[model samples]
Target: MDEPKIKNMEEFAAVSGISRPTISKYFNDPDSVRKSTRRKIEAALDRFDYRPNMYAMNQNRRLTKNIGVVVPYLADPFFAEIARIIENHVLSAGYRPVLLGSHGDPDLEIDNLENLRLIKPAGVLLAPLGRVSDAERLAAFCADVPTVLFDANIEDLGAAFVGSDNDQSIGLIVEYLCRTGAPPAFFEIRNPVNPNANKRRAAYIKSIEALGHKPHLLQADGEGWEFEQIGFSEGTRIIQEHDLPTDTILCSNDRLAIGLLSAAYQAGLRVGLGDGCALRVAGHDDHPFSRYTCPTLTTVSQDYAAIAQKSAETLFALIDSSKHFDSREETLFNGRLVMRGSA
Candidate 1:
């Protein structure tokens, strides 16, 4: 049967067979009603899929079960994968989900955020553009709209933050590379986009030192999220210039590794852990496309499920309270190493 479109609360009330005032109470908060009333509303909801206008509900200073999820770059498979996970959670929780991408542009990020504010979303799960983001604008937005930060965080912004533990993830890979072959040189962008890059670099240095091995960095130049291009270009340059100090390389993220892989391939340098392989490469994030590369990438996988759930849950809590948290909560989930053919 075709589901009837619910144009307004009146239509919803008529279909639900509940009084407008009572339905209003339920919409305000499901638990506000008696168990019987709650059951009735829920039953109607299941029989005919009807969701209140998120914007209208918010305009009345009442919450709608609407959430906004924004990412720095959606074209990147990593963000696409994570956004999908978050969307499923929002749908299952009976909230409408909206997804937006910044395309690695700060202006677009601010614009997306402003658009979300106009909707007056009950809450938002944001993966900000890190250092490029307008912190003041974001903090002010969060102050008015319940928000949770994930993927990247800004100090003193939002009600809470959730992300990967870069230290643990990078350390895991660095140790593995050292134990198996050579102390890998870290390959990264000279001007990286994500804030997580800095933490991963720190962790790489710490991990190598702790293992009694000297660390090296192959800092490449890049802007925005063109990680692969940067890595590839840099890798090519290093190969031509004979600048590399180590046979093994660990990248800040998979995108850069992808670029580096291309460079190695063009240079006819074999990449793998086996005897005949001339170079061994590893990366972080285990990007969705990582497994499909010519030589499947060996990388650390972020706990996307955990990050999504934690972000959603924290945003909901802030929405329920209708207040910003005085003390911001920071949560970081660890990454698990996945060995592949590459390294």
Candidate 2:
């Protein structure tokens, strides 16, 4: 005769003649139970195939092993990539990862956090939509749940912040451009979505002025995460209308630079360091597709690996100790300059 299938821990306990609470304790941590009890549980496991629902098991416990990872927009490859790294780290540390995307909406960001609270996650890793995020609500949420902010920060809302140092990154690219060729003009969205854009703008101005160059701003018109389209549309208009004040252009990020490159191609303008090239373009983030553009692209690469590793480690430390840091911590990784064909 075939062995009976045990549907859950309860059924297994009943067949093994073990109390349900003892079985529950064993499932949580086998070492917590007495040796004889553990032997009985192991014997029953050999006879019957029973696997507890991890989610259900966590639901019953006071503190769960779930780690929530929230990003501003998962559709963007940058956020998706970083979220993947953070998830792997959380899983390796023996915790469940619950992923959520805000889609660039503040309300949705808040909703994601609220949902994470329902599960009582061990901790949270959030890449907030800076500037647009509701500061009061986010602060309150962080107060109740231990959260480590990454990517874009919102001041002192979280236990810690981990991201790239915009000042160092933008300055590195700016100095490089000034050294090799003409001082580059900063290209940015008139109304930016990420707060890092503001930092880059300030850094560009400061770096250019320090080098004794007059900074020219080529602010484009757009909002949200459609950076490429904005860059293309605005770039084309600027080129056609003879609006660009400088031959060298430094986009706020690589996605925008990619679109600008397309625009330059459309305008019959050659871009690169080679002879006969009419323009030189560069950007930030060293976007995954930057190297494949027509003339490639010279850009700043964010230290995503370091940011992800530190954020995960910090959150886990908080969870394990059940204690908050005496003071909030912020870790900023410097960006590396990636020189390609574009500039």
Candidate 3:
């Protein structure tokens, strides 16, 4: 008599003499299992002519193998670079990455969270639009999902937060600038959107004071992420009106520095460390385009690799253990100063 037909994954697992969990693992990602296990499963599949229903299996599982990665703005190269690293790590861990960008909108940020919830993702990595993000909604979402916040953080809103230590980074650049030339003035948007800007402003003040130099702030009037335009327009006004407190300026970020560079160039001001140079410019975050500017920008480089790795690892740990931490965790990496012609 012919052997009985295999009806389901359970029957196939029993006949193949493999554990059910291992069978499920192979089905979820064939390469996830060892080569030996894969060959055995393939042989069994050939003999039984049975294939697991992927959709049904995912539905039955307690958690899907999908990891959601949401950022405040995907257009920003900084976010794009970090997201790419996180995506690679997620794929390597046999989980699918679902990437979403809020385009710097708080309402859209909430919408992204709600959509992720519908998918029932195993975990999430979020970079919230700080200061504007709905705190109550974020807190509620974290209560239900395992999330690791990166880049911009909202206090106590995720399982953990991994980001650059703004204090250390700002201080590093400030000390470098003060040592090289006259103490630098801080330039930033008057009402900033990112939480990091506030931290950086405070850090600049603290560092300058420690070095016995008065802090000067040049607040530009504008909103949203059009930092370059704000920087150029305001920088032009400052330059033409002779309003700059110091010859050297430290922008809150590279985009602003780029704009300031343009303004200075248009005003016939030389920007560099050599003779005939009228001004020095520096920025933070070492933005992707910073080095390519006419006079390369000097800035502090955030430890992007470390932040990405730690954030992903933290979320994966939470998912695997199937538990939240007793207390929230935050890991901060220091920045390194990148010296160039601009400063």
Q: Which model scores highest in lDDT?
A: 3
Q: 104-138 in candidate 1: lDDT tens per residue?
A: 88889889989987777889999999988888888
* Residue 255 CA displacement from its true place in model 3, Å: 1.2
* Alpha-carbon TM-score of each model against the true structure: 0.88, 0.91, 0.87
Taking the tens digit of each residue's C-alpha lDDT, what string does model 3 give over 1-343?
6666887888988999999999998887798999999999999888877877654676777799889999988999989999999999999898889999999899999999998887788999999999888999999999999999999878889999999999999999999999999999999999999999999999999999999999999999988888899999999999999998889999999999999999999999999897999999999998999999989999999888999999999999999888999899999999999999999
- Tell me the whole-model lDDT of each prediction, alpha carbons only: 0.89, 0.91, 0.92
Every model: Cα RMSD to truth: 3.4, 2.6, 4.7
Tell me which of candidates 2 and 3 scores higher on lDDT. 3
lDDT of 2 by residue, 244-268 (tens): 8888999999999999999999999
Q: Which stretches of candidate 1 lie over 4 Å from their true place?
A: 1-54
What is the lDDT for 32 in model 1? 88
How large an RMSD does model 3 have?
4.7
Candidate 2 ranges beyond 4 A from true positions? 1-7, 15-50
